[model samples]
Target: MALSSQTTALAQIPRVHIFPTAGEAADAVAEHLLATVKRNPKSVLGLATGQTPRHVYAKLVHAFREGKISFCDVETFNLDEYCGLTASHPDSFAAFMQRELFGLADFDPRKTNLINGDVQDVVAEARRYATRLKESGAVDVQLLGLGTNGHIGFNEPGSASDSHVRVVDLADETLSANQPSLIELTSVPERAITIGIADILHAREIVMLATGSAKAGAVRRSLREAPSTDCPASFLGTHQAVHWYLDNAAAAEIG
Candidate 1:
């Protein structure tokens, strides 16, 4: 909802805002997320991991410490996880959320849902996670990080628009971008379990954040180009309540 009054629409898109700095954009997003929690204590949050949301999570953690919010009634579902890493792995999305948000906040362990990537039956795990998501009623808001290759939640460029949660082969660009330095290059995960585009669109509200010049092209295409699987983020244009938060660098390629 009007988190920042300094909003502008691009083409037919809704609520696109370009902040002067990444910190400002992140602060606005954190405030918006906290507003949702305050309005609905039982809100189901669709969370994301990566540099894009790191600052936002920090703000959320600060709010929890300042008694501005409580996650006692909030439930969280992460976007995706590496297929080979254990939840305890330092590089895993689960561990990242723990270190960045869950560990710093007051979230209930039982209510925090993350795909366990170490399981033997990855397909069954995906289905099970999807069922859990469906049982949650619906996600109040979904936070997303745009990949350089126009992916979201590890849903690669060629992903189906109507696809559901599933295990997907990681695109070369994605693997390269996320390759852990501590592990051998060959040991890097080649697959990930991600919620599908359909699941993401089901959220009542979507907040897509992109920063840095590397994201400029994807951000431009997402808002200006036709909705196509070639740029998975472009499909976000079809959602009625999508808000885009970008810094000047990310918005540079936009006309």
Candidate 2:
């Protein structure tokens, strides 16, 4: 695929590390994340929430408990949140972060920010989140997970590569993908607030984790496809530095 003004050639892409198993990939990724954070002791991180990062969060929490990592100085912003849900809702992203990382990690609530999805003024909240990201400076490292559809954050198919923080309509697959275990797909929110492709490109570094056979096709397309709204993550090839960590299942279709 030809490179557009927005994307770099695939040959220039760097730092992809594939592993034999999901467990191995998670461990390596956690080491890279924690080690990078230890160097600064106070990094502004762009964090994504989902099943892919569950083990990585467990690693971080374990380190904090063992006195090997401290999050008191780390500032974090989540990539997206489901609309109409309060932070305390069991299915909310805020609650996921609380259950997955913060509660055990001693992360300061004052320094951790999550976009309020239930606010009446969702657009205003998105703009405010963008402002907070700018003030925090370039995210030291953004931890992301791929959707089976190749979307990043909530920038689904046809999302502009230059998109920024905004209110987004959830794709049909995205809604189903986020549906809780044993829960009806109709129960998931149809809208979300997400930091867009451009917002993530501003990060100092980007690390994306993809595991399982379900993500194999999307993972391959994300790297092989040229930068296009059709595959928003394909734009990552344009980034100066991006680390793609894939387990065997996710890397199955890729060379």
All candidates' TM-scores? 0.94, 0.92
Off by over 4 Å in 2: 1-13, 181-186
Number of clashing residue pairs, candidate 1: 0
Q: List the pairs of residues colliding in candidate 1.
A: none
Error of 2 at 161 (Å): 1.2
RMSD of 1: 2.2
Instruction: Residues 1-255, candidate 1: write the lDDT tens digits.
Output: 443444334423458877768898888899889999999999999999988899999999999999989999999999999888899887788988998999998899999999999999999999999999999977999999999999999999999889889999999988777765333335568899999999999999999989888899999888889999999999999999998988878888884
* Model 2 C-alpha lDDT versus the unseen true structure: 0.86
What local distance difference test score does each model get?
0.89, 0.86
User: Which lDDT value does model 2 have at 161?
Assistant: 79
Q: Could you list the CA RMSD of all candidates, in the order they appear?
A: 2.2, 5.4
Please state the error at residue 32 of candidate 1 in Å.
Answer: 0.6
